[model samples]
Target: MRLFRPSRRAASLSVVLAATLLATAACSGDDAAGGSGDDVVEVNFGYIPDFNGTSLLAVAQDQGLWEKHGVEVEATSFTNGPLQIQALGTGDLDFGYIGPGAFWLPASGQAKIVAMNTLGQADRVVAQPGIDSIEDLEGKKVAIPEGTSGDMILTLALQDAGMTKDDVEIVPMEPAAIVAALSSGKVDGAGFWYPALATVKKQVPDLVELAENGDFEDTVAFPTAFVAGNDVVADDEEKVDRVLAALRDAIAYRADHMDETIELTAEFNDLPVADVRADAENVQVLDLEEIDGYTQDGTFDTWLSGMQDYFVQSGQLPEAVEPSEFYTGDLFLGAGE
Candidate 1:
């Protein structure tokens, strides 16, 4: 399922809901991290409720690394990307661990990606019986979230298969609905990232994974990145640095405590520990070198440009945005400080 950018409809809806969020924020007491010291910074962190970079944030919270770094993290969990983007736009969330939508949303002028959180094999396509491969997908109904990573995955998959959107019937579905649709036989297959991908695999034993985001030739990394709201990064850049530092510590903690990290992911996502561990093995927490490569080697720009082209071609995005404008590695550069 796609962790998508906000559609026109969702954007319009956010305008009405944003007022409620503002009131809620106002009534929720001090927005600052719960301390009086100048060194202390309050950070409202957001993440998807799954086994992605959120697990790293869980490690940070569990290890008290955020506090140790002089930042108080008030963590909030959302189920998907668009909601997280909406929260960022409404000033309700300052930081997020998000999927490809992270860049696209920011390209739409909502937030800014500060660091690569986890980048590896995450997005997947599960096909039902008779759909043995991407080639078998022709004429079948395939579900994907438009204007998001899932859409890009499908496009790449089709390219790999020597097919195009016209070769299959594409159905737009949300991440939560994709599994249900597939299980109920409403769609022949679906594309999404985990823990939803893991969820569907657990629930639908017969479904076979046809492809993963890593399977793509050009775009091998399926990244869930750390992003700061535009205002948040502008107002207190140091806090952004602190948050990245805490996450770096958390990633190290995850490396040393794999079993515990898997357990936390399983419990938080309500999945079997085995599934969590299996999925975790496929995801690589981005290190400084790899993260730097994305910025310096023009890999991110190439991928983003390709993604924007697909979005525009598919009619999901009205126009393309340049990747270099919204992506950054500055916070990550200062993370060790």
Candidate 2:
């Protein structure tokens, strides 16, 4: 069985390099608690297996790039973005990779999005072959992580097909459980990201891809980004900078060395290399420039507004909270500049 390992060397290096970067940027001061050469800053980051951004994190750790930059990054796996955001708010985590929906909690004054990490077309809602059409999902069981980007997309697809959530039995489950649920005939459809989607399709050759972001016009923003607590960012600006810089390099490496990145990601996730390669076709690796545009847009703001509206209509949140409160593009833009 493939197990996950967090890189101690990378994490330690990230902290140290972060301090140096901040000092070089002329942003360091006594109030900033400037660390001596011996202080080891620890940054805990959360990631999900299926997200393409995780590959970058895995590479950064395995390669010790973060260490070269003087920062320490500990990457942990979370079941989903919501849980990851929850951890960020409670200070159990320093940073994490999450979908656009993560802005909701942060907008509610819980956390903040430090940087828009990666943007790409990766998520897909797949159904059994015979059920090619979304309408066919009626009376069928569909599995998705509740309140996730996938779930929202699934809902939109259903609505577009003149159907509603009531038309199908929605089951809440993690990506790992999705394949089994479909293979066992317990679920007629599932909304998931690449590697997991590839695994499910491999087992169920007749799987149908119902919908993806690329299929929808005027909806190009899928802000899957790295977020940190406000306290974390304020307490260690240098560390945050180093983390972003390392990730920026990792992203570059991913774009330049697709095969190697895919192989490592496949190994990290314990999936076949061919499966990872196939999934790579849909993965969008964002550079610093692209990430800047994504965060500036009202894309995340608009999405949060839509989600808040949905929550209010569904009785999820008390009412629509302010979107600006949840997200701040300062750190993301600052890092790129």
TM-score of each: 0.77, 0.77
Write down the lDDT of every candidate, Cα atoms only: 0.73, 0.71
Candidate 2, residue 219: the lDDT equals: 43
Residue 316 displacement in candidate 2 (angstroms) = 5.1
Candidate 2 per-residue C-alpha lDDT over 1-337 given as tens digits, one digit per residue, 9 for 90 to 100: 9997659998889889998898776534322333334544678988877536578886787776666555677778887788987887789999888775444566566677666665557777788878888888898989998767677667667767888889998999977788788877789897666666766766788788889867753543556767788788778777787677677777768777778888888787777788777777776677655665655866656755766665555444677876666666665566523
Query: How do the residues 205-272 of candidate 1 rate in per-residue lDDT, one tens digit apiece?
Result: 77878888667646444567777778887887778777888877777777778789888877766678
Please give the lDDT score for candidate 1. 0.73
